[model samples]
Target chain A: MDTDLARERILDAAEDLFYARGIQAVGMDAVRDAAGVTLRRMYQLFPSKGDLVEAYLARRDARWLDSLATHVDTVGPTAQARVLAVFDWLEDWFARPDFHGCAFINSFGELAGTSPQVTAAARHHKDAFHAYLHQLTTAAGATAATGAQIALLAEGAMTTAAISGTPAPARHAKAAALNLLTLDARPVASPA
Target chain B: MDTDLARERILDAAEDLFYARGIQAVGMDAVRDAAGVTLRRMYQLFPSKGDLVEAYLARRDARWLDSLATHVDTVGPTAQARVLAVFDWLEDWFARPDFHGCAFINSFGELAGTSPQVTAAARHHKDAFHAYLHQLTTAAGATAATGAQIALLAEGAMTTAAISGTPAPARHAKAAALNLLTLDARPVASPA
Candidate 1:
C-alpha cells in the first residue's frame, strides 16, 4: 500500500478498536492485525502505540468537528438553529448502532492518568468544541458565556446518552439550550 | 480486623487508588497494600475485583450524593436555591486537590463495555442522581423534565472539569441550570 493509504488504514483500525475497546485493552499487535498491515509498516508509520493513539485522536477530532459543522451548515443558516443543530446531530449520533459515546471522552477517561499525549488531545478537542459553541452562541445574539453554557449541556448529553444507552438526553439538553438561547438570562443570575 | 472494619479499609483504599489512578491501572495487590489488609482477607470480603468495584461505586454513590445533599440542605433552604446548590457542591468537589471527576463517570468509562456490573452500577447511579434532581427541581417550581435538563448540565460540568482540569465548567453549568429553572421553557421548543 502507498504510505498515505497505509497510514489511513492504520488509523481507521485504531479508531475502531480503541473506541470500541478502551485504549489499554487493545494491543498494538491487534491494531496491526485489524489494519492488515505488517508490524514493520505499522511502526514505520506510527513509531509507537502512543503515536498511533495520538494520530487516531487528532484524526477523529478533526473528522468529528467536520461532521458536526457539515450537519450544522445543512440545518442552519440561522445561528440559533445552528446551535440546536448540534444536539440534533448528537441525537442522530447516539442512535447509531455502533455509537459508544464521544471517542474523546472515552479515550481521556481510559488514558488520562497514564498518557499525557492522550490527555492533551482530549483537552484540545474540548477546547475547540467550546470555541465552536462560542461562535454559534454569539451569532445567536448570546454572549460567549452563553456559548460556554451550551457547551456544558452538549458534553453532558454525550456522557448521559453514553451511559444511559439512550438518545433522550440529547433532546433534553437541546430543550435547555433553546431556553438559554432565547430567554432573558440577566435576571436569572445563578448562585455560582 | 473485624469484617466491617476490614471492608471499610478496603473501600477507602479502592476509592483513593481508583480515583487517583484509573480502575484498570490499579490491581488487587495495590488495593491490599494501600489498605494494609492482607490479600486473603481482601478476597474473602470482596470475592472479585468486580465486587470491589461495585462496592466502591455503591458506597461512593451513597456518600457522594449524601455529601452534596447535606451541603445543599445546609446552604439552601429554598427550593430554587437547592437546585443551584448542586453546582455549588460540584465546584467544591472539582476544587479538591485530589479531584479527578465523578467516580461513576470514570468507572463507567473505564469498565462499562467489559463489565456488566460496572455498566449497571453507572446507570443506576445516574438514575438516582436524576431522581434527586427531580425532587429539587419540582420543589423549586420546575418540572421533572427540567430536573433532567439540569442533570445533563451537572454531568457535563463533571466531564468538562475533569478534561479541562478546571472548576469553571461547574459554574458555567450552574448559570445554565439557573436559566433553565426560571425560563419559560414552552416557547423554546427544540428542533428535535
Candidate 2:
C-alpha cells in the first residue's frame, strides 16, 4: 500500500480504538495489530502514540466542524431552524450503537492537563462551536446578550443530553431556541 | 483513624485522583498514598479497586441527586423554576475549581464496555436523572410527552456544556427550562 493509504489505515484503526475504548486504554501495539501493519511501519507512519492520538482527534474535530458548517448552511436562513438543526444532527449521532459522548470532552477528561495537543484540540472545537452559535444568534437579530444567552442554552442542552441518557436535553434546547425566536418576533418552526 | 474516617479518607483520595486523572491512570498504590493509608487498609475497606470506584461513584450520585431534589423542592410551584433550578445548581457546581464534567459520564467513557461496575454506575446515574426530570416535569403539569421533550433538552444541555468548556450549557439549559415553563403556562424564574 502507498504511504498515504497506510497513514489512513492507521488513523482509521486508531480512531476506532480510541473512540471505542479510549486513548489511554488502547496501545500502539493494538493499533499496529488492528491496522495489519508491522511495528516498524507504524513508527514510520507516526513518530509516537501521542502523535497518532493527536491525528485522530484532529481528524474528528475537522469532520465535526465541517458537518456543523454544512448543517447550518443547509438549513434555510432562519436562525432558529439552524439551531434546531444542530441538535437534530446530534440526536441522530448519539443514537448510533458506537455512540460515545463528545470526543473532545472525553479526551479532555482522560488526558486531564497532561497533553497540550489534546487540550488544544478540545479548545478549538469548543471555540468553533461558540463562534458558530454566536453568528447564528446574531443573524437572528438577537442582541449580544441575547445571542450569548441562546448560545449558552444550546451548550447546556448538549451536555445534559450526553449525561442524562435522554432525548429531553435536545428537546428542551429546541424549545429554548424557539423561545429566543419568539422573543424577537421571528416565526418559529414546529418541533419535528 | 476510625473505620468511618478511614472509609471517608479513601473515598476522598479516590475522588481526587479519579477526577484529576483518569481512572485507568491512577493505580491502587497512588490512591492509597493519596489517602495516607496502607495498601492493606485500602483493600480491607474496599475489597477491590472496582468496589472503590463504585462506592465513589455512588457517593457522587447520591450527592447530586440530593442536590437536584433540594433544588426542585426549593423552587416555587412552577415547573419552569424547577427546571431552571437544575441548571442553576450545575452552574454553581461547575464553577468550582475542581469541577470536571460529570464523574459518571467520565467513568463511563474510561471503562465503556470493559468494566461492569463503571457501566452500571453510569447507567444508574443516567436513569435517575431521567426519572427525576420526568417526575418534576409531570408535577409541573406538563403532558408526559412534553416532559420527556424537556428532559432531553436538559440532558443535551449538560453534555454540551461539559464538552464546550463553557458554562453556557447550564445557562442554555436554564433558558430552555424557562421556555418549557412558558409552554406549560407556569411562571418563569429569573435566570441564575
Candidate 3:
C-alpha cells in the first residue's frame, strides 16, 4: 500500500483505540495490530506514537466538523436554524454506538498538560468551533458575545452528554441557545 | 498513622498526580512515593488503582461543592447573585496554580469508557452539580430547565478555560448565565 493509505489506516485505528481506551493505555504495537500494518511500516509512517496521535486528532477534527457542517448545510434555511442544527447533529452523533464525546475534549483531558502537540490540536479544534458558532450566530442576528455564550452551551452539552450517558443535554443546550439567541426579539417559554 | 489518615494522604497524592498528569500516566509507585507511604499500606488502603481513583473523586466532589457553597453563602444577598457566585468560584479556581479543570471531567475523559467506577463517580458529580444549579435557579425564580442551562454554561466554561489556558471563559459563562437567568425580565445588552 502507498504511504497515504498506510497513514490513513493507522490513524483510523488509533482514533478508535485511543478514543475507547484513552491515549496512555494504548501502545503503538496495538495500533499496528489494529491497523494491520507491520511494525516497521507503522514506524515509517508515524515515527512515534505522539506523531500518530496528533495525526489521528487532526484527521478526526476535520472529519467531525465536516460531518457537522454537512448536517447544518443540509438543513439550512436560515442562520438561526443552522446555529441550532449543531445540537441536532450532536444528538445524532451521541446516539451512535461508537460515539465517545468530542475527540478533542477527550484528547485534551488525556494529554493536554503534558503534550504541546495535543494541546495545540485541541485548541485549534475548539477555536475553529467557536469561530463557526460566532459566524453562524452573528449571521443569525446575535452579537459575538451571544455566539460565545452559545459556544459555551454547546461545549457544556458535549461534556454533560459524554459523562451522563444521555443525549438529552444536547436538547437542553439547544433550548437554552434558543432563549439566548431569540430573547432579544420575543417572549420565550420555558423549555419543556 | 491511622488507616484513615493514610488513606487521606494517599488520596491527596493521587489527586495531585492524577490531575497534573493524566490518571493512566501515573502509577501506584509514584503515588506511594508522593504520599510517603509503605507499599503494603498503600495496598491496604486502596487495594487497587481503581479504588484509589474512586476515593480521590469522592473526596474531591465533597470538597469542591463545599467550597462553592461556602463562597456562595459568604457572598449572598440574593439567590441570583448566589447563582452567579459559581463563576466567581470558577475564576478563583482557574487562577489557582494547580487548577487543571474539574477532576471528574478529566477523569471521565480518561477512563469513563472503560471503568464503571470512574463513570459512576463522574456522573454522580455532574448530577449533583446540576441539582445544585437547579435548586439555586428555582430559588432565584427560574424554571428547572434554566438551572440546567446554567449548569451547561458552567460545564462549558470549565472546558474552555482549561483548554484555552485562561479564566475569561468563567466570566463569559457567568454573563451567559445571568442572561439565561434574567432573559425574561429585561434586555441583556449582548453580554457586555
Question: For residues A1-192, what per-residue lDDT tens digits would candidate 2 score against the true structure?
Answer: 789989999999999999888788888999989998888988887888888888898899888878877877888887667766876776666666676677877777677546778877877877787688778777767766556555555554544555555555656656656665565554233344
Write candidate 3's Cα lDDT for B1-192 as tens digits: 888888888888998999998888898999999998999999987888888888888998999899898899997669899999989999999988877888888888888778889889998999998898889888888887888899999999999998888988899899889888887455344532
- Ranking the candidates on TM-score from highest down gives 1, 3, 2
Order the candidate numbers by lDDT, best to worst.
1, 3, 2
Interface RMSD of 1: 3.2
Error of 3 at A120 (Å): 1.2
- Steric clash pairs (candidate 1): none
- Candidate 1: list runs displaced more than 4 Å: A184-192, B184-192
User: What CAPRI-style quality would you assign to candidate 2?
Assistant: acceptable
In order, what fnat does every candidate score? 0.58, 0.33, 0.71
Can you write out model 1's per-residue Cα lDDT over B93-157, one digit (the tens) per residue?
99988888788887777777688898899899999998999998888888777888999999999
lDDT of 3 by residue, A53-158 (tens): 8888888889978888899999867888999999999888877787777888888888876898999999999999999889889988988888999999999999
Give candidate 1's error at residue B147 in angstroms.
1.3
Worst 10 residues of 2 chain B by lDDT: B183-192
Badly placed stretches (over 4 Å) of model 2 are A71-80, A141-176, A186-192, B71-80, B144-146, B149-169, B186-192
Q: What share of the true interface contacts does candidate 3 keep?
A: 0.71
Residue-wise lDDT of candidate 2 within B1-192, one digit each (tens)?
A: 799999999999999899777788899999999999999999898999889988999998998899878877887777657766777887877676767677876777678647777777887887888788778877777766556555655555555555555665667557656655556564333343
